[model samples]
Target: MNQLIRTVTLLWSLALTTGDDTVTCLYSQECVLPCKSDYREIIHWQKLERQTTVNVHSFYSGTDQLKYQNEAYRGRTSMFSDQVSKGNMSLILKEVRTQDRGRYKCYTAISSANKEAFVSVKVKAPIKSVDIKMTDDGITCKTSDVYPKPKISWTINGTPKIISPKDPQEDSRGLFSLTSTLPVQPVQDSLTYTCSISSEDSTQTYIASLTEEKTEIDLGQDITIPCPGSQGETGNFTLTFGSSTVLSYNSETPQPDRIQWNGIEVKVTSKGNIILHKLDSERHAGTYTCEKLTTQSRQLIQTSVQIRTASTVGIIIAVTVSIVVAITVAVIAYVIKKRRSKTSENNGQEGSGGTGHNGTPLDDRLQSEQLVEKRSGTWTD
Candidate 1:
């Protein structure tokens, strides 16, 4: 009867000492698998895998025994050495990976007491951002720094389009980048596209369009690129010329000097318009994109600018005027030459018909009389 009572008490004590918990961890971040006690001598933390056990960390004899630590968890697991005497047996795991999601067993032992705890860890990598851009080939949807891989899809004007995306490229940190394109030839000018990136637990979407605002600016004139969703509002704004960042703005503390294109300085208006003085076609004519980052959503707007030089127009007008003047001069010369030719022909005809020296027709009677008089005078002499 005494043996039975002792066995019952031991079983109750063991039951009271053992504990289980669950913790949620973010991928690529630090997490603490919690274990606590008032006494500690040896600690062992291990992951429970199917049909096997993997060593995560272990501490004994007043030092960490990590020589037998699992290769996958090396340099990623540690415990608070100073707090071990106070019975803080929590393990600090850094750079948590998706593979670390499983059951972990923390065994703590001392001279007269022993306790064990189980922590079920769940690691997640949610969708962060989805970026969509307009390209010559088409509009491309892209995202980076996501984990567990992701699926990208596109919708055109509310109709889902079937697309084959490239394989998600994995980075050195085990995150993934995904990109997909859509040909714009068959799409209408007012077409809109929405790109969605889906993970196991979250989805992020961004909407973009082929309809771009067109602005024509004269060369040497100042150009202002406006932020799309920032009318009277305030937040973070990023302006990019093509692929280069031209300006970055924050409402708390604005730094207009963050404009980094072509070693030029610019001004940001209260309404979030970035002004670039003395625009040059070679330097300033292209796509300008403004992105507004807010807590609820991200807004993007694009503008296509064309720079016209006044000198070019002036040259064209000058050439046109010069051609007109040359044509008028040629016509005047031809008319004058025609009149001179007619005058010469009339003079030649009168000369051939025996006209007087002053170009007059001679009277036959007068001429005969003059001849008789002259003849009489000669005979008398």
Candidate 2:
């Protein structure tokens, strides 16, 4: 009966020890496996593999003993030597790997009293950034620093399309990078395209249009190009004219010299709009693209600028010249009209004495009247 009671007591004591713990660690990052013990005479952290137990880390004999550590975790496993005296036996693991996901045991002993704890670890690397840009072939979507692989999908004008991307490329840290392209035509009307990147942990999507927004600008005038759909965002921006990059900077980076682009002064607003001090028909005319780059995705807004043949100053000058010419012509016409009027008045006065009502001079008219009066017996006429 005493043997049975002692066996029951031992089983109950073992069951009351530290319960199992689960910890999720990020890939290529430092992680801590928690364990607590009042006594720190001897400590052992072991990994329970498929068929055998592997030494992850050990703390005993006044220092850490890593001579028997597993080859895969030789330089990655460590324990807090100073904190162990206060009942903290946590293990510090650096540069965690996917292969490190498993069960771990933390065992510590002091004389006859001992304690142990169990922990389960999981390592993951989530999706970071997805960059979408225009290419000669089509629109390409790319992302890097992901784990457990990722899938890229496309939606064209609200319709789902299944386009397989190239196989994900693995880096030295076992992370993934992928690229996918979708063929698109130059569209007069806007065509909406949405690309989504999905990993084991989460999903991220980016939307862009294939159509270009049009803006009319006069030559030699300042103009501000709006970055559509980016009103309140603060992110890395790149402004490109046609295929040449005009300006590129992050929100925190210093702005480049404005007069660097062939004497064109460029200014960026807090909202990511760009202002050109002077618009050049030859160089500044064409497509202007604004891209907002973030950790999740890349957004694009394009504007096609058409420069007028005449500048504002040139138009004003032309109008002024036209008004001046009109005034000069009016003045010349008025002078010629006045001179003709005077000449006609003089001619009327000079010709008045040359002919009378009966085609006779004044003296001849009087003699004729006297002859008529003698014939008609009326001399007073």
Candidate 3:
């Protein structure tokens, strides 16, 4: 039909005007605007907008000439000169901004023919902040002001959570504020709920937690405190007590021990929980702080740990030691008594004065008679 041909032509024109290629990137991150084909001799990048075309970058005579670059792109855009050969002419943009969204022109002046590529850049607005909490109703997630509205959803224990999202409100600055709540039902096992917010380019999340202000464990018992993750984004968790970092994950430490992440009482898990085995009163008991950090955000939670020493174990050990000592004393006394009895029996065989070595009379009647006869001469008649 003529109408169909006209619609197709209009669509083709719109595509050519908008661009064939598009690059979506997050705010405050690097973006690579790609342009395939070799333009080694000369290349020019320009931001094309309505009624204005601003110079972004230019390469000529084997050197980058930035004097014509727009001030908005100063020090934020660069092309990979080393990779310019073999039909590669990609420009790297650092810290992309929403205002930078527009069409870009990559023109290369070749001797045979001029080549060009048009690209459309789409900048994603990062979720400024994410706050999640547990309430009587259920888990609630709130977002800070975001532009163009972010994609918000919930996942419970890694499964998609069916939640009715509240209507987002628009602020005066045209930014949007969103809230998503997931009603919790009675569940037997502990459940983990994560609120994920995403833009076209990046995703960030916050997970719910059910931790007390403090945890108490008996000394020599194992304890594992959960790290519920960060509000915005987190790549790692760090556990610190006093000045010492007991354990760290995803930290840039060069030591092999740090690489393996082993501690005396503290160990970091992939789920972000810090596990302590055989809790030590001296080392493992105190205020332990857990920090989750991403490249852009950080979350911290400090929990007091009360280590209780099992005095009953000590008492049992003491009682067992006392019993052993008493038995040893009784055995020594019995051995001494037996030795004395044997010495007395040996002296009885060699009894000279009737009383043996142990002060017992060896021959009672004979000894008494002998003593009286011996004393008769000394006594007066």
Candidate 4:
């Protein structure tokens, strides 16, 4: 009876410990088995002398089974304890990533019966810590301490695309990792691009875009378009006026314009002055652009011309009228002075009774004398 009672007590203890179980862990962080306060009680405390066995298994296989499977955790993960007493099974992981953080199970098995404890693990990565780098070729997105692994992808104006590893590599810390390179082809206008990362339990995302700088100018004047001052440099350095190539120099100077009607050829001197002469009217208004073929620098210059007419007939008429008016005034003043002198001489001859030229009478003689006197006075005074 005592032996039967002991066997029954043992079976009851094992039964009490058998059931579906779980082990929880914070993503990318350490996960403890048996949890903090979890333990199994034996029905007869004095009956069993050996510690029970606990089996811990991850739901996924290979590297995926361990916490964190994304690129962010490529070089930083490890397990804590492989095995322990039935009441104390758990795993310790280093540099826990968000994906590594999650729920795990600990199973205590005795004979054919099993008991389980479920644990929840939470993982987090702050958005503020996320860094984004944008370049002409593509963009780089990164963050630290996200567990398991995060799914990386890109979005262009709301369209989604996956970001895969350019080449797979492993760090000294034994974390799985990858890097992705994206091709950038821009349209006529500006565009925006976004990068995002996700896991089974949480998601983190980043975004950035591209912008182009532009300039404009007008025609019919003079301009200096830059050249590829150095070698082995590449860029879009174009020179155009309206739809025509006014001047174009990239790796080398281009051929001169066959038709010089609206445009003219510009010769660059050793002093860096571009000389162009007689740019006509039709090409009067438009933009001229000069840029360094290899460098990012650029400049724009504009040109315009205004023509004036001269009036010949109006000037000739004004000069002729002035000369004629001056000559007429001089003649009139001379005639009036001569008439006044003659009248005074006649009056003086009558008053003095001077002899006339013929010597006709005494009065005539006196008149003649007076006339002589008057004439002499007029001549001297």
Candidate 5:
């Protein structure tokens, strides 16, 4: 009896020596059974077998509590031997989920004395799959198989933005499912958008991109190429006529007349109008293209000219005849001048021959005078 009293006294002292009890457990996981302290006075710690039981209590649920038998904790809970020896009462939980997150109190009873410890469990949900939907005006993002319900947001080019909830519902899976709709004000066809969801333990991000279709205007007549004001983007632009560049603006002034056909410069006016001055049938036919230098986007406009072949042929013939007549007249005038010069030369030579060194040769002078008289009479006739 004295020895039993001494063993009981030792057990009581051991329990009292273990200061305030503390329990630790992860949220959403199976709770662990806290281990009881062993009587230090006992030489063989393992030999002194003590039957222990654990109970979980919650202040929120009145008159309701959980009792965990030793067999019930077989595969669920475990105790750290080191912590148990140091009088540290802590619970190690496993396979925790969001629903398992809450406040817990662990009670360990050995014989008639009981030790209690308090702990808070926190569980975090991991993002599973990300779903992205794209529309003409905006984008929608969703995630499933997640716990603790993540917060959703948006990002464009890595810039963060707030996303409000569009439709929210909670399913039987005890998961918060929500859809976020972002209004794409005056939607831009070239911008890329992204949606991101974040949770305490994990983060999931999805990307949805939209491309806007533009209406092409066939520039049949005069047209304006709208220039983005201060909000404009700088890029290479091409102005082409049937696969050929009529004009190109690439951050600099183009070389003038570099692209010319048939001695005419391909001209784009200051107001962005392509003017085909003196447009003839050959020059007016074919398609004109306006294109983005870096992309495959192109706008084609075609034009045609009607010409009268007969009128053109008549004008050509008239010019040819005039040239031929002028050439013929010049040739005839040259021939007449040469004949007159030869005749004058012959008359001068005969006169010189008639005039002798002695001032006259009587026969020669008589012959010359007779010849002149005969020629003058014939001419008069």
Candidate 6:
């Protein structure tokens, strides 16, 4: 490796280029290093490190020659021979590896003058996520199974601050794992602490937040729930009711349907609060959470939401039942009135039938009274 490093340095020192060029490639992806020359007499490609130079590919005469190609670049490196006549001396490096990251040199010789160009290959692995927590113990940032050890750092608001990480542990595959913690200190302003991971050429961040105050809302009222830790600022946010996403808001535009901001049940306001209109017991009575997610960082508070919906609203606010009760009372009163009227009608019908108290016909009673009156003269009037 030392010999290779020296050779690379010598080649770079000897080679000349018009301007510096750097090429970025995703890990495990193919990359091409641009090198073009009119001369086909000889061609060479080498990987350059600080102290070592490793041969990558080569061509000469009418045939291919790779006897000096480094073992690391053996099968993964290739050149387009057909384009050599067009002064194209580009080299294709296949399936980029973490160890393959470095500067590469391509030199072509024709007659006696040597023409060369250099291109640097950078392998990038973006940090996908980081674990973060905020509590009485302060903040904790952690990650594991990361290729190329990572550097964890913290920022209050957006200013860089001092952060110390625990000793990193390397796994059997040479991957690294580590953790860092930042102690909590009282701050009068709304506090937002961002934890970031620097992995290779990419970065990822997670945010821990402390809200300004607790929340309280009345039942049957429209409640606008601000994202936890937002400090009352507009931003990209997501609101979750129970375990489901009730709404999400992006500062870019308005969304429709479900958490789309136009759908039923929830609305993302201009102030960044999720408005729960006409709160109901079944849907709005449970726990709620607000989260913030971005490509560089992601954070979710399983309990970020504390919706202490007043439980006293259980019985007083049954408006529909009140209407039903009023209708029922009216119906009962009408039925009683109708039944009394019917009873009065039946009594009048029985009295109109006119049966004498002794169960005799009225004509017979009159005739008896007349006969008695004829004999005793007491029926005259």
| Per-candidate total of colliding backbone pairs | 0, 0, 2, 60, 3, 7
Model 3: CA > 4 A from native: 1-22, 36-42, 50-52, 61-68, 80-89, 110-112, 124-131, 135-138, 142-148, 155-194, 200-381
**Residue 292's lDDT in candidate 6:** 68
- What lDDT tens digits, residue by residue, belong to model 2 across residues 1-381? 999999886765452268889998989999999999876898999999999999999999879998898899978978788888888999999999978889999998876567879999977787766766678988888878877788777877678877765899998877888888998756755555668888755543434333346777677888787664555555787888877888887766655546457677888776667888887655678888887777666667777777876565588799999999999999999999999999999989866955755556666767888999899887763
Alpha-carbon local distance difference test for all models: 0.77, 0.78, 0.69, 0.43, 0.47, 0.67
Tell me the lDDT of candidate 4: 0.43
Model 6 TM-score on a 0 to 1 scale? 0.57
How well does candidate 5 score on lDDT at residue 296? 17
* TM-score winner between candidates 3 and 5: 3
> Best by TM-score, which number?
2
Best by lDDT: 2
Each candidate's TM vs. the true structure?
Answer: 0.66, 0.67, 0.44, 0.32, 0.35, 0.57
Q: How accurate is candidate 6 locally (lDDT)?
A: 0.67
Instruction: Pull out the clashing pairs in model 3.
Output: 37-87, 38-87
Scored against the true structure, residue 297 in model 4 reaches a CA lDDT of: 26
Give the residue spans of candidate 5 off by over 4 A.
1-94, 109-114, 157-164, 184-189, 200-381
* Ranking 3 against 5 by lDDT, winner: 3
Quality of model 2 by C-alpha lDDT? 0.78
Residue-by-residue lDDT tens digits, candidate 1, 287-371: 8887877543455767778887877779879999999999999999999999999999998987677665543446665567678
lDDT of 6 at 173: 44
In Å, residue 328's CA in model 5 sits off its true spot by 44
TM-score of 2: 0.67
Residue lDDT tens for model 6, 193-289: 6776777444543344333323445655666665654444335677766557676666556544434332346766555556677654534455566
Give the Cα RMSD of candidate 5: 25.2
TM-score-wise, the better of 3 and 6 is 6
Where does candidate 1 stray beyond 4 Å?
Answer: 12-20, 111-113, 125-131, 153-174, 185-193, 203-211, 217-223, 232-235, 242-245, 255-266, 275-283, 293-299, 310-381
Using TM-score as the yardstick, the better of models 4 and 5 is: 5
- Write the candidate numbers in order of decreasing lDDT: 2, 1, 3, 6, 5, 4
